[model samples]
Target: MSQTSHFTKVNRRDLLSAGAALIGAAATGLAFEPKASAEKPSTGATHTEPSATAPNYAPPIVQIQGGQLRGYRDGKTTVFLGIPYATAERFELPKPVPPWQGIKSAQSWGPVCPIPPMAHVGIDEFVFPHRYWVEDEHCQILNIWTQSTSASAKKPVMVWLHGGGFTNGSAMEAYAYDGKNLSEFGDVVVVSLNHRLNILGTLDLSAYGPEYAQSRYTGTADILAALQWVQANIAQFGGDPGSVTLFGQSGGGSKAARMLHTPSAKGLFHKVVTQSGGGEVLADQDPAALLKIQQQIAAQTLANLNLTGSDISKLKTIPYLDLITAGQAALRSVAQANNQRAGWNVIADDNYILRQFCDWSSDIPQMSGSVFSEMSSNYVKSIDKNSWTPQQVNEHLTAEFGDKKDAIAAAFKTSFPRKQVQDVLFFARPNTRALAAKAQAGHASVYNYLFVYEYPVNGGTTSFHTAEIAFVFHNLTEPQVRVATGDASEGYALQDKVSRAWINFAYTGNPSQPGLDWKPFSDADPQTMVFDTVSECRNIHAKELIALLPPPPAPRF
Candidate 1:
């Protein structure tokens, strides 16, 4: 925990010197040359260069630790797709991939980690266009988009973690995750990656033997390994390794929060951003309880597969699909017996990740926020938004809030007088206040924001889960984004403002941009930036409402 043990701080002077040395090396024959542009080949491949107008177009190639990679070009950005950072055996720590002899074509996305199909879920179903991909265990790959391929560029780095809890989701699960626009617009290096998940990543075997002592945290360790790789090699892609920021949404946000307390992830990143997935007090699990759950699932899985304890090693060799099916069956069995839902995912374990949500004395700056309405109105079907009555809203509120419905409704209406009853019903005040309270208690500088941008889809789902993604990445023109937000001109304007704030945060710890004066959250006022059409900072604590609500759920892991 000592500061001396953290990564040596690389000052501006050191970065300049390193950049100068890289340029000098490149002047000689030490560094590889940029690939020469060529005309379209007769093969007519998808990655072929355009020959008529942009005849001089050629993908930029960079030399990494493993080998040379030829990445495609997108206007000002150079994108290296499907670059492997690490490899691992089933349920084991990741190891750096062996260096190759020749250039590797990094032109397309790599296979994603196998995840159960969840398109039937309404939220995912809406974003289904971005979900399909070839899934495989060779999923430990990263995608990078940089404005400069020169090592001397020294741009700030931003690594994105995808948001499918520990169980599902991939780096490119959503079109909003694409880094081309963000990297180009911010003039910063953007990176995202895929890692093991579900049973393959989080199955805890430490109770069985010392060899598996770290099993509970392999998924997180894979992220650590990716960060380590970034620290060592990102400079080659014009990134300043010393100024890296870890940012994510939903599950990815929780992972980012986990890294804040993880010893291995210490110093690998300088700043953190958690959107919607910030408060997971239950991230860590009691070892005995976790072991019991794992054992129960293991027994059921083995019985289903007609295998005994002696065939344990064979579990690793089973088809990935079969493993998922067995894991699901075991989880259902355990959940039924224990009268609770069960999952095989990241456990605090108290080894890699300490048993704390936020460390008051830690120096890492953090930014956490949730959408204005997440999973609130999405559950309602066939409801007439235009003809809905206030009585209907009150009835639904009574059903959800019980005896305190009127008190909560009155408080919410007082704060946002213009908002509809449905809007008041789905307001994310409770969870957002809880997250802000945790962040304010920490010693580090903490900023909170509420994404209030309403999507013009599904009869206007206002700031629903994942709605802020397109704006954050400045990807309003993406296909799925257009489907979600019609007439994207307004969305584009908001995207510019929001993405600039994010870029500013990555560059410096402060997220304040030109027109936006984003103040840090304080325990007294608890200010939050309301990211709406006119974006303004506001205090969000309806003290009476918050006090009436039950205490936030306890850590469940």
Candidate 2:
């Protein structure tokens, strides 16, 4: 199978164009991940959060390397929030926290790492609800939910990296990110954390000095540090560090997949699952070329601040908006100048975190996929496709597929008998299947999936980006039920199957369950587990339909 072309070496204009599509993809769900940084956290005094969910006043104390800490209890799960894993100075790699003399509070969610906000994708809260937190530059923290705190319980640990590219997003950015339900439902430990991102995290200043050599990679370094902390201390929290699974969506997923190639990341995580975002990270690009792009952005940011690289130290005290705004302008200028799609992605320049490709062997079990209609739902959000008359559907299909509309419709119907004719207009990106193919080709055993579960919302446009997250987390329910997925009963049933498969995959490196016999994807036997109302495995065949349809329009990055 030929690899899907995403960020191929194109003219500078084409590069920026690609960024628009990718950023749109991320916005829809995968890349729908960024926002600008808020004003820098008050620096004179220690930052404090407004009253939120604080740790319980008593009980649930668990001691680790940092100090003794207390978390609250919720239902069957023992929940811990805002636990610091490491700390760092601006634009530097993280450092170990010194042990405190007294028990620290792990009750309230910690401050989120500040990020320069990106363009919004006009997502309705009804589809993907978001949660914002107080922002701080010193946000190196984590949250945990588990059934037990005993070291001997040894449950599988699922550490989530947030989306928002390396630009914006926090551990607590979304409502579905709450790990309590997934933790309790799967009988596994769930951990999510905040880290450095965007300009602060990925700006390359190594061109000027060694102190900032790893600055561009620090966003990832924060994650790597968190994993190291988990391996070292999770045993005390009833998690088997040896069984850690690093999974994420969009930017988070892309970053998690990128970790596979980092020399320091081995053994820290045993399994990997990336949904709808890893394809951008695995593109084979010249690291040196990326380095030049990053340097240009950083230099531009510096000039925007009216300071040269020699005064880079002043960046530590710059306001979040000043820094972010400068950086954002730098990105746009560089994007236009180079006409090259530039990213805040780490320029694989060091041994700490390598620029990623197929950095896996058969030893690491993996799963990677995209939503069935990753961008289709986002594109057609304003139109009510399901209710469209046959003529209307044909008109739309004709407008999109031109003379090839009939062939495409026939192929789509033949390929998806259960699907409505309009579904041919909302096809999954070839990149999703391409991502799975890359994983299979790069590793020994890789489980693949295509999330086809039509969300019962907006007349079954449920297969949009980020739709499956509610299911994977077992979170689609109640009052807001119809907003996310209609037919609560069917949604509930599918959640059980989807969430359990994730839990099983992390628990034993196999996603197969009693009825859904998931087989590893391979060249000789390519198969993908289609997750929907009736989850089942099928051969890879979306290619025919994708081939016949017009190329998908570039999504707004």
Off by over 4 Å in 2: 1-57, 117-121, 281-283, 355-360, 378-380, 432-443, 478-483, 554-557
Best by TM-score: 2
Model 1 over residues 1-557: C-alpha lDDT tens digits? 11122358667578998788788878895864443577554576556545755612555778888889888877777888999999888778899999998889898898788886564645445632465687877688999999887889899999999987899889998888999889978999999999888877887765456767787677888899999999989999999999999999988998888786677776799888998885766443575686677768767877788888777778767877677788888888888898766886565656677666535326777788888767654424534453468777777778778998777777777665556655665666535543554554566678888887766665666667787888888887877767766555677888888899899999988999878888888667678887877787778655655676555454442
Give the least accurate 10-residue stretch of model 1, judged by summed lDDT. 1-10
Q: How close is candidate 2 to the true structure, as a TM-score?
A: 0.86
Per-residue lDDT value at 285 in model 2: 59
Candidate 2 per-residue lDDT, tens place, 1-557, comes to: 00112235457578798789887887777744444587565678686666555544456899999889988888788988999999888888999999998889788899887766656754656677777877787788999999988899999999988877777788888777889889988999999999888877788888889888778888888898899899999988899998999899888888887787688887899888988777754345577787888889989999999998779889877777788889889888998888767667765564565544435444778888788787667335566677889899889988987999888888887766677887777776546543554555565468778888776666556487777777887777533533656656777898899899899999998999998899887645658888877778887467777777767555432
TM of each candidate vs. truth: 0.84, 0.86
What would you estimate as the lDDT of candidate 2? 0.79
Query: Candidate 1 lDDT (Cα, whole model)?
Result: 0.77
